[model samples]
Target: MWVPVGSMFSFIEVLPLVLLILDAMEHHSLIRKQQRFR
Candidate 1:
């Protein structure tokens, strides 16, 4: 019971890290596209 709850919290904590990495990747791709167009 407690173990499952702790795992849930760990997943929640990792969610933001995943989102941050995705956001950075998207920004990097956009910058690359703009550079290519120029």
Candidate 2:
């Protein structure tokens, strides 16, 4: 029981970092597109 709960807690901790990385990547792509248009 404790093992599964511990894994779930770790997953929750990592979720935000993953989301942040995805958001950064999206922003980077947008910047690239804007630069291309210029």
Candidate 3:
């Protein structure tokens, strides 16, 4: 019972990690494009 609860909590924790990774990737690509334009 406790294991299932803990897993759910961790799943919530991972949402922000995934979002941060995606945001960083998008920012990196945008920066590269800007550099190329310059």
Q: Give the poorly placed runs of model 2, Cα more than 4 Å off.
A: none
* Model 1, global lDDT: 0.99
Model 1 worst lDDT run, 10 consecutive residues: 1-10
Better of 2 and 3 by TM-score: 2
Q: Estimate, for each residue in 1-38, the C-alpha lDDT of model 2 and write its tens digit.
A: 89999999999999999999999999999999999999
Off by over 4 Å in 1: none
Q: Positional deviation of 14 in candidate 3, in angstroms?
A: 0.9
Give stretches of model 3 more than 4 Å off. Answer: 1-3
Model 3, span 8-28: residue lDDT tens = 999999999999999999999
Residue 10 shift from truth in candidate 1, angstroms: 0.6
Residue pairs with colliding backbones in model 1 are none
For residues 1-38, could you state the per-residue lDDT of candidate 1 as single tens digits?
A: 89999999999999999999999999999999999999
- The C-alpha TM-scores of every prediction are 0.93, 0.97, 0.77
